[model samples]
Each structure stands twice: as structure tokens, then as C-alpha cells.
Target: MRKLETRTIVVASHNAGKITEIADLIAPFGFAAKSAAELAFDEPDETGTTFEENAAIKALASAKASGLPALSDDSGLMIDALNGAPGVYTANWAERDDGTRDFAMAMEKVQKALQEQGAEKPQERTARFVSVLCLAWPDGHTEFFRGEVEGTIAWPPRGTAGFGYDPIFQPEGHKRTFGEMTAHEKHGWKPGETQALSHRARAFKQFVETCLEG
Candidate 1:
């Protein structure tokens, strides 16, 4: 078992939602998490071809830049109908004309593409959100964890709570979309909650158990 020696760690991401969730998860371990944005850390190019590689790139970049332990994640939706397209390029698919990412537009594009391919049924829309977490130390030691949540894509995107493709993703055994769940509901203490069901949460759980709790 390995343990992190730092009290203050950097979350190597600019996404506020990601930063917030990660901060919450590590709080119990007596870690004071800070976002790379807060530290004005320059965003590094994510040139990796896989989620784990990308996560490691970001984590190492931040760790080296800040001289502190850094945690980073690469997560995205992978649609079977699309042959796992938009996997690493998920965010790229959501880029709008205004240079901002919009999940609504991204979802619309997905539906349009699927429709073009004659995929209309829920079963045909099978997909999953995959997350890979990487923890890196300034000295170059690194760890990785991966997790995924299977679901089907729902048309007419539902919910308003979660960010990204949450509105259109319906987890298996659940009628409601992730976007419909409140923060507390999404990350609640109970089993089957988002904290338990979410890919990021699952990956972070492994991180906690293997690194923080050791």
C-alpha cells in the first residue's frame, strides 16, 4: 500500500465541476485540494491517444509545474453506435462556434449522426462514460485508475443538474438521467447514488482506498 505525503494537492483541471467533485472526494482524507485554475497553471496540451495517457500528461504537467502532488482525470462518453467515436475527442465534439463547449449542441450532433446511421432505438444507442484518473508526484511517481458507467442515450435530452452529456445518458436500471439528479442525489451517501455510480466517483474511490487510506 502506498500513501500520499502531501496535505495540499493540485487538481490538474480547469473544469470547475471536475475540480469541485474531486475536492469533495479528497476532503475526508485531510487533503486540501486546489484547482490548477486557481494557481494559474497553464493548460498543457493533451496529446495522448488514450484516457490514461491524457490523465497522466495533465497530472505530471501540473505536478512538475507546481512542485506538489497532482490529480487529474480524462473522461468522456463513448457511443457504441459511433464505434466509440468522440471517445478521446468528446470535448472536441462539443466545441461551439463561440469557442465554448455546449453539451446541448454536442448531444444534438450525436443524435443527428445516429439518425443518419439509422440508429433510433434505445438499444441501438448503447453507450458508456469512461473515466481515468491519474495521481502524479513531483518526483515522477504516478498511479492510475479507470472506471466506467454503462447506459443508453436518450433522445430529447432530459434533466438539468449535471454537466456535459448527463442529460442524455440514462444509466442502466435507472429511469432518470444523470442531469435530473440533484447534487446531493448524485453524490449522496447511499449506495447506487452518483457517488457510487459515476465513473469519476468510482475511479476516485479506488484512488482513495489505494492511496489515501493506505
Candidate 2:
């Protein structure tokens, strides 16, 4: 693993929600982070079929452009009933013709699809959130960490605290959706903890252990 000495790394994403969450994650560790949007980095085409591929595409692009280490996350909600219809295309589902993303519309699409598929029961609505984090350096060195959280799709999406598909995802053992939880509750772990609740957090924990200075 490459030791990341630079603290001010690019987040490699234009998503505001992702940037905020990532910034929060790295804040306690005292590392400075800037998003690709802030740095005016061009968002690259994610032609890869898998999450790792997409994440690496973004991370590497920023690393090369900025000559600094970059971290990128490609995440999505996958419903078993839908055969993971929106896995890598999760964000694509939220894309509007005007180029703005409407996650509310995306959530409705998920619910509609589930209803059409006759996925009424919680078990039938079983799903998982997948997150893949890629850390890339200017020299082309890269590391990948993947994480997942099991959950069921909820109808009439609840809460507004989270972005994307959080309102419709009811994680296992939790009555409320991720949108209902605060950042602390959604992250699911503290600094020294071994486990995390969310897929991004789980993957981030792995990245921190391997790349960041302790």
C-alpha cells in the first residue's frame, strides 16, 4: 500500500452530499479535503461496468489532474427484486434532462418498480447499498475498498436528512431509514470501532486503516 503523506486530497466527486459526508469522515482525523467541484476538476466518463472501475476512473482522473492523491466513491442502492436494476446506474436514474439530479424522482422510480414487481413484503423488498472507494495517486498507484449494508426498500420514502436513496432504505435491525438518522447514526461507528453501519463508512474504515497516517 502506498503511504499517503499529503493531507489535502481531492474528493474526486461533484456530488454535494458525498463531499459533505467525506469531509465529515476525514475531519476528525485532521486531514484537509477538497472536492473535485471545488477544484474545478472535470468529471470523467465512468465507462467501467463495476463500482471499482468507476471509482478508480474518477480518482485517477483527479490524481493526474491535480498531481495529488485522490479518493473517489461510487455507490448505489440495489434491490434484489429489481435484479439490481440501478446498481452502477444509481446516479443515472436520478439524472434529469436539464442535467440536475432529482433523487426524489429516483426514489419514486424505485418504489414504482417494486410495486410493479409485486415486491410487497419486507423480504421481497430485500436490498443492499454498495459502496466502493478508490484511492489513487498521481503515479497511477491505486487501492480499492468495497462495503455493503443489507436492507429493505421502504415505500413513501421517509426522512429528509440524507441524500440519494437513503429515505427509501430501511437497514436491517433499524425501524427508520438512513434519511432518518443523523450523520453519526448513519456512519455507525466511532474512530476506534471495528464495524460500521453504512457501506461507505465500512469501506472508508478500510481505506483509513490502509492508507492514512494513524
Which one wins on lDDT? 2
Candidate 1's residue-wise lDDT over 1-214, tens digit each? Answer: 4477678989999988888777776776677778899999999999999999999999999999999999999999999999997899999999988888887889999999899878999999999999999999998999999988899999899988878888998888789888988755555433323357778877877777688663
- Over 4 Å off in model 2, which ranges? none
Q: What overall lDDT goes with each candidate model?
A: 0.86, 0.92
Listed per model in order, the count of residue pairs whose N, CA or C atoms clash below 3 Å is 0, 0
Full-model lDDT, candidate 2: 0.92
Q: Tens digits of per-residue lDDT for model 2 on 111-174?
A: 8998999989999999999999999999999999998999999888899997999999999999
Error of 2 at 129 (Å): 0.4
TM-score of model 1 vs. true structure: 0.93
